[model samples]
Structure formats: structure tokens, C-alpha cells
Target chain A: MIRLERRKEPSTFWRVANPFLAVILTMLAGGMMFVALGKDPVTAIRLIFFDPIFSAQFGSYSRPQLLIKSAPLILIAVGLAIGFKANIWNIGAEGQYIMGALFGAGVALAFFPLQGWYIFPLMILAGAFGGFLWAMIPAILKTRFNTNEILVSLLLVYVAERILAAMALGLMRNPDQPGFPGSRDLRRYESAHNAELIAGTGLHWGVVAALVAVIFAYVMMTRHMLGFHVRLAGQAPRAARFAGVAPARLVVICLGIAGALAGLAGMFEVSGPGGQVRIEFAVGYGFTAIIVAFLGRLHPIGIVLAGLLLGLTYIGGELAQMMLGLPSASIQVFQGMLLFFLLALDFQTNYRIRLREEVRR
Target chain B: MILGSINPAVLLAALMVAATPILLAAIGELVVEKSGVLNLGVEGMMIIGAVTGFVIAVNTSSALVGFIGAALGGMVLSLLFALLTQVLMTNHVASGLALTLFGLGLSALIGQGYVGVTPPRTPKLDLGWLSEIPFLGRALFSHDIMVYLTIALVAGVWLFLSHTRAGMILRAVGENHDAAHALGYHVKRVRTLAIMFGGACAGLGGAYLSLIRVPQWTEGMTVGAGWIALALVVFASWRPWRAMAGAYLFGGVVVLQLNLQAAGVRIPVEYLSMSPYLITIMVLAIISSGKARGSLNAPGSLNRPFHASN
Candidate 1:
């Protein structure tokens, strides 16, 4: 029988290898699921894992969609990863995302029928501020009252959803479309629209922001004192305290940054691909970003790649659903499996397995 | 006359029904936390239980079997968690989050064909003569057997945690796993069992939602009930009786808000829809700020993964 033995230092090999192994395992498991659902597992798996990138028919269209989807995910996850590094959980980025969209849309709507360059920049600032303010509720509560951030952040998501619905139905509804429960299509407004920076490519302000965030995060994580404190805080709280890291301040700053980034993602999506504020505007990006954060091993650069990979799954999962008649829920299951296997395999990084003869006393 | 027409007995009955799922889940989580394991996958497990119960109940035409299936499904899911956190010694928070996502997806996959299908109705308790009591009977005694079971489970949990030797060991493990291990207790084993028990209760809660409350299968019908249950456990300060009370209070809010919406009260439906979560958070903030010792009651090893080795 094999037994796991503790290791003095975590294995660097497995630390890098586990995510790759988990991906393979998820494919095997997901393929079986597809087979059970009466679909050709090979074709189904191909569509999900490979076709979006390689298939001639889908590749041209799907390629652009991948970047479009990955931008917000990467942006949100970058912020989340930083906070998670500090052992601060900001599970309510989804709520902050919604509020950001609302705030950005509010600014755009306020300047309806007007043309100005300042409007977009102003909306971006407002959107980030909106998310920041929303995140502060949990941060302040946690710092002052010592409440759990996880529950508070998550609960705020439901509240934010309700507010989003209210805006779609009431305050933010497009005046021209008298009966529709959606705000004006920001895509149609020239000054307010977050249009593509490059023709035929999916390059937009959001994509630029995501790249900038990634580079900034990479630099901060590698070279900054705050980053060292965050890593120190997570690894050893008492040591961090002795080293003069104020836990409360770190909590607020980490959460604030995460919230702002998530808000920017929301604002970008609303102006870019999402086009307008609607009841269903907050698609599960905030939630999905959690997976991105972890799969990237909380590394900024790794997060970008993970975001794109997950984005492929989203596009490919949809393709499989349409072409192979697979259930949409299968994708969610597939994503969950990735995390499960990664966590399970993470055991190997910290321990070694050995086979030993039965010990006879 | 108008106030009288808004019958308190009916409102109380609805409140109990609303509370049962959360109460069951919270009490189960209380035990898990008491054993030094925190499983945040309650929502995932509950939804899985819901779908499993719904599918089984629809196919077998038996609510009892449905609940069994739900419990099994939840336990099975929790076992994955046990393996990850207990055996592999992974991060509890990450593993729990993964479990929730997995449960939601798995339930949806299993529930694909069962969408819009009605579940076999769970029978309300028939206490013959006792049912004839004017107000109390209808409010308290008229619920489906799960409601009574939930109440009994709370009492059982309270007794188990406070009085029994096994309960003491579990609490000791939660308080300080290293010390408990030094005393020759199997910390991992105790935690695994606690996680499974929590999973089973969350399953029952999910089953109750599908078979008794909503009485139908719907994707994401559990919504955020599992999260609410998690919050309730904290609001209760990990106490069984207090958990039940928190559940009832939350249930009361839910029932009241729905009633207000149905009665066409002047408040926006969106605000009413969000009231329960907002109220829970507000209450949580208030309770947390009141006393430092209150939060300290949380088991020391609550979210920490334990390994026999250093």
C-alpha cells in the first residue's frame, strides 16, 4: 500500500505539474459524462477542448470571442489573486461587478445624447469607485467588528443582483424602448461606447486594461514591499505581525483593489460586449474568476493564461451544446472538476507517497 | 379586521416551512464546525440533494426514498471533500468552494430530464385530535414530518454536543486538534465523520426544499439557501438551539416579505426580494460587534486541515 509522507519543502515539480494533470483528468471524467449522456465522447471532448482553437468552421469566429470573454475574467481574477495572496477572501466581486456596471451606466445615461471624450474616462473612474465603495462594506465590517468576509461578500452578491434587476426594470431602462427592461445600448453611443481599438481584432480598452493590470500585478508581486507583506501575512500571521504588517489595513487595501478591478471588468463588459445594462447582465464571470484565480496558482501571468483557457471552455462548451446536444451544466461540472483535481493533486506538492511492507509489531 | 384577516397562525406555519431547510443545514454545519471542519459547500450539497430527491421522488413516487437519495448524494459529495481536505490535507476554503461548484453542476446535469417535474408530495403529520387545536396545532403540528425531524435533530445535536462523551471528544478535537491527537483521538476520522454528517443534513434540507416547499424540480432552486444556512450557523454562534432560532427568524423575514409582495405592499418587489440577505448581514454585523467573546466561541481548528504528521 502507498502512504503519503510529509515533505519539509513543497515540491516545485508537482507545483507546476498538477494543473496540467488536472486538465487531463477533467477531460477523461468529462468525456465519460458525455458518453453517459448518449453523445460521442470523443467528438464531444474534441469540441470542448480542441475545436474552438483548431476547427476550421469555428476557429475564425471563436478566436476573437475567446479574447473578448477572457478580458473581464483575467481583469477580475488579477485583483482576486492579490487579495487571496493576502489570505483575504473577496467572494463578492460579482456584486461589486454589478454595482460597477450600474455606476458606469449611470454616468453614461446621465450624459445621454451628448458627445464628449471625458465621459468614458469619467464613467470608468465612477465604475471603479462604485466597486471600491461596495467592497468597503465588508472590509470595514470585518476590520471593526471582526466579522467573516466570505459570508458578507457573498450575501452582498444577492443584494447587488436585486439592485441590478431594479435598475434594468426601472431607473436604467432605455427611455426610447418604452417597454423593454434594459438600459440604452451603450454600443450605439459613439462617445460612451468601449469600441474595439483594432479593427477585426477583439482588442479594446478592457483588453488593454487587463494587460496593464497583469503587468502591474506581476511587477508588484515580484518587486514591491506590499507584495512581500501580503505573502508574509498569508504564510505566517504572527511573523507578519512582528514584521509590522497591519492586518486590518492590508485587508482593506487588498479588498479595495480586488473590488475596483472587478468593477472595471463589469464596466468594460457593459460598454463593450454586454452593450447595455439588463436584468441578466451579470453573467457568472465574477464566480468564474474564482476558478481562474486558483487555476493560475494566484500568479498574475498564470491567471491571464488560465482566463483564456477557461474562456475557450465557455465558447467550446456552447459549441458542444449546440453541435453535440450536450447539456450546458456539463461545462460547470468540468470547471469544478479542474479545481477538485488541482486541489487533490496539490497534496503531492507538499508530500511524498511511499509503498511500504505491512509493519509487523 | 384587516389585521386579524392576516392570520398569525398561517404566517407562523409558512415561517416554519421556510425555516426547516436552513435549520436542518445549519444544525448539521454546527456539528461539522464543532468537530473542527468547516464545509462551505452546503449550497452545493443542498442543491445536489434537491435534485437527487426530486429525481428519486418523481421516479419512485416516494418522498421517503427521495430524502434517502438526497442524503446519500450529499454524503457522497461530502466524501469528495473529506478525501481532499481530510486525507489529502488541502485548503478547506478552496476545496469547499470547489465542492459547491461541483454540486451545482452535477445536480444540474442529473436534473436535466427532471426539469418542471413535480415531486411526490411529502405528507404533513396527522396528529388526529391534536390537529383540531385552534391556533397552535395548525401552526406547529401541521407541518410535514421533516419539520418535526428538524426540531428533533436540533435537540439531538445540542444534547450530543453538550452532554455525551463522543460529543465532548468532537468538541475537544475542534478546540485543539493537536492536543486531541496527543490524547490519542483520530482527528481526521472525527472530522471526516462530522463533514459527512453535515453533508447528510444539508441534503435533507435540499430534499425538503424540493419535495415539500417548492414541490418541484428547478435548476438552482436552492438559490443561496446553503449560504444563508452557513450564515445562520455563525449567527447562532455555533449553538444548535441558537441556529434553530436564527433559522426561524430568517424564515419569518422571508415569509413576511413574500406576504408583503403578495399583499401588494407599496415597497418594490426587488427590495423585498433582497431583504432577507440584507437583514442577515445587518444582524451579523450587529452581533459580531456586540461582544468580542461571541466570535471567539468558534472552534479553533474550524477551517484548518489536520494531518497526523507535523
Candidate 2:
């Protein structure tokens, strides 16, 4: 019987190419899923993948949304990738996003009826700071008390959700829409709105910040000492410690960066598209961003492309939902399938599939 | 006078029912972790179980059949994890996350038709004369079969880990897969068994929710129970009995907060609702200092992949 053997070390070519192969497999599987759901799989697939870029009906409207959706995802994923690369798991970005919205929107509401241009910047700063502080709970707990960051971060999401519900229903509820469980529309205000600088093209400040982050992250990974430390810590904890890569500092930096980016994503989202803070404002972006980061292979540019691809699916999934009568869940299942196959294929990159040897009894 | 209003008897019954699901899930997860696999897919698996149990029980009107269906649903989902992490040697963290994501998606897809439909009530089992003994009766005897099963499961699991040879071998594999492999133990097989067991327990927990607690199918109904199970294991510090203690403590906190809300206690609903998670973190902080983190007994290779390469 023919058997494949694992490489002592995976090749660079295989390592980089694995994600692309995984995407292709996911597409094939996704097409099959669409077909199973009784839709014209080809038309659905085209609408999702090809039509967004070239089809006349949607290309104009869809193209701008690409950047709009990708901005927050890229921002959040980039920060998460940094922590993952450093072996620090921050599973509470959803909570950070909620907290960021709470803090940023709180600022705007406090300064309501006053149109100072500087207030927007202040809110942005506070948003980032708020997220950073929430992340610190787990980071500090991990560094000081040896608490599990995974559990700590994960549990905080529930806490944050409760806080969001409270604010929406109680303190931050719009006085005008009495009894409604939602916050004031920050976007309606001149000082708080995060509108596109380039109008219909969807080029907003958040997108610019994301691109800047990608470039800076690329440089950091390729050249900087801190980036080197992050990679080394994940690859070899012993070597990292010996090389004087302080675990405490890395934890704080990774958590802080991730929190800030999630915060920015939250702020931009609330001010731009969502327009108001509500109990369900997050819509699982934080969790979905994890998939984006992995699909990008944790590279900054890769994440941009991955983010756009995922964003297209989001738009396509909604379209399919409306047009084909496909349940909204099919989209989530498709995304889950992508992660499933992506993780399954990661094995081929590292180890070749081989049968075990029989031992003499 | 205050005692007259508290209704300690009813409160005990509610607490027992509330704790059963978490206890079942946390105990299963504790075993899986003790075998050195951190399965974070319990919530997803439990949700699957909840829907599956509801469907089966509603159709068949047999609570036993519902639980059986739940265990089957959970085990099947867990087999995916077993295949990926145990057989393919994929990263446990990523695979566990994928399991949950897939479970969530699949459950939501399958359960869309069942929403707004209530399942048949789980039949409560009476312990004959034992249930007539005042406070003790309500506290321990007047519950569904699953609650007793859950408590018995805790004791059984505790004994299995502390006494049995198979349990010892499983622990050995978790502690050092290579050593276990060298000693002719099928480390993968052992771990796979642990994963299935965990999945079944998670399934029972899920079934308890839909078939007993909520009595209806709802999308994302288990909410964050899986995460709570994960935390409860940590709180228990990986011990089976400690898992029981941790689950009861969490359940009490949840029930108390709900009671406070019902009583119109002046606290904000948000603060009251947030109390459980916040209290868990505080408890984590108190017990987490320096030494007691994750039950000082967590296996060295808890989340590592084992490659049986020559």
C-alpha cells in the first residue's frame, strides 16, 4: 500500500499555499451546500464570488461595501493575529467591542448639544482606552495570578453583553424613543458621525486606519525587534525566555493592541453603519474576525484579502437569503464549513497522511 | 418572618434543577481535560443535545429516549473532534473552536423549523418515602431522573478517576503521551474515549435545558452554558467533586440574581444579570493566586498534539 510520510519540517511554499488551497476546497463545498439547499449553485456562487467584482447590477454598490465591511474586520483581526502569534489567546474581543461602543458613545452623549470637532477624536481615544482596559483584566489576571486568559476573556463577553443590555434599556436609552431598548444615534450628530470622506466609494477614516495598520504590521513583522519577539515566543517559549522576551510585557502589549483595535472597530461601526448602540449591535463580528485572521494566515496583507472575501460572503449570504429563500443559517454553516476544512487542511501542510506501522504482538 | 417568605423548599428544588446541566457538562469536561484535551465545544455540543432531545422527546414522548438522543447527538459531534484532533493531530484549540462554530451553525440550521415549539415536559421521578422527609426530600429526591443521574455521574466520575486502572492509564496518557505510547497504551484511543465521554455528558446537559429547564427549542438557547462549563471546570480545579461544588455555586448565584430581579430588588437588572459572570471572575481571582490555577493537576500536555512518528 502506498503511504505518504510527514516532512521533518514543512516547506515555505506549502506553508504559504495551504490557505489558498483551503479556500478553493471551501468554495467547492460551499457550492455543494448551496445546491443541497435547492438553489442554482452556479448563480448563487457567481453572485457571491464573481458578481461582486464584475457584475453590472451589484459591482458599484458592492465594491464600496467591500472596504466598509473589511475595515473593522481587518482592524480587529490584525490585533488578534498579533496576540495569537505571541501565544496569547484573547477570546473576548466581542466584549471589548461592546465596551468600546459604550465608552465612545457615552462620551458623545455626554457632550451632546455641543458641536466641538475635537470631541470625535476624544471619543475615539476613549473607545480604544476602554477596550484596552477591559483586555487588561484577563492580561493582568494571567500575568499576576496565573489565571487562564482563555476562560477569563471568554467569560467577560457575557459580562459585557449584560452591560450593553443595561445601558440600552436604562441609562443610555434615547429619551425621545421612550421604552425602546437602544442608545441614542451617535451618527445623527455632526461631531459623532464617521461618514465617508470620499462619499459613495466607502472610503472612511476606519479604512485608512486599517490600511495603515496593515503596512505598519507588515514592517513590524518583517523588521522590528518586538515583532521578532512575538514570533519567537509562540514558536519557542523557552528560547523567548532565554532571549529575554518578557512574558508580562508581551501579554500586556498583545492584549492592549487587540483591545485598541477592537475598540476602534466598535467605534467606527457604531458611528458609521450601525448608527446607534443596541443590545445586539456586535452581530458576532468579533468571533468572525478570528476566522478572518486565520484565513489570512495571520499576515497583514493576507488578512486584507481574506477580510474582503469574507465581507463578500456576508453580502452574498444576505442576497441569497432574500432571493433564494435560503435560511439565514446556511450562510453561517458555509462559514463554519470554511473553518472546518481550513483547519483540516492545515494538517496536510504540516504532516503527510500515512498509515501506522504494525507492531509485533 | 423573613423565613416565611423565602420558601426554602421551593428554592432548593429550583437550585437542584438549575445546577444539573452545568454539573453534567463540567464533570464531562473535567474528565476530558484530565486526559489532557481541552474541549471548548461543550456549549455547541450541549446546544445540539438540547435541540435533539427536544425533537426526540416531543415526537416520542419518552424522556429516556430524549436523553438517549441527546447523548447520541453529542457523541456524533464529538467524533468530529476526535477525528480532527486525536486522529489527524490538529491543534486542539483551533479544532475545539471549529467544533463549536460548526455545532452552532448546524444546530441553528436544523432547529429553525422547531422554534416556538415546546417539548413535552420531562417526567419527575419520585424516590418513594425518601421524598417525604421535609427539607432533605426536596433538596435531594424530588428531581427528574437526570438530576440524580448528574449527581451520581459526579460521584461515579470521581471514583473512576481515583480508583480504576483504565482511568489511571488515561491520566498517564494525558500527563505524558510519549510515555503512555511507549508503555503500549493507545494514547489516541484513550483520548478519543475521553472526548466521547465528554461529548455525551455535554449532550445530557443540553437535553436537560430543552427537555427540562426551558421546555422549548430556541436558537442559541444554551446561551453561554458551554463557556460556563469551561469556567466551572477551572473553578473545580479539575476535580470531579470540586466540579459539583463549582456548578452548584454558579447555579446559586444565577438563581439568586433571578430571584432578586423577580422580587424587584432595587439593583439594576443589568447588574443583577451580570453578577454571575462577574462573581465567577472574582472567584477565579481569589482561587487563582500563584498555585491553584486550573487545578494544579491539569495535564502537562493539555492542549498539545501527539504525533506518533518514529
DockQ of predictions, in order shown: 0.81, 0.73
Candidate 2 segments exceeding 4 Å error: A1-5, A354-361, B1-4, B291-294
Model 2: fraction of native contacts:
0.73
Top candidate by DockQ: 1
Residue pairs of candidate 1 with colliding backbone atoms = none
Rate residue B206 of model 2 by lDDT: 95
Going through the candidates in the order shown, the clash numbers are: 0, 0
User: Could you give candidate 2's per-residue lDDT for residues A181-268 as a string of tens digits?
Assistant: 7988877898998888997888887898888888988898879999999999999999999999999999999999999889888888
lDDT of 1 at B21: 95
Model 1 chain B: weakest 10-residue lDDT segment is B1-10
Superposition TM-score, candidate 2 onto the true structure:
0.96
Question: How large is the interface RMSD of candidate 2?
Answer: 1.4
lDDT of 1 by residue, B81-162 (tens): 9999988989888898999888998898999998877778888788887878999888887888999988999999999999
Fnat score for model 1: 0.82
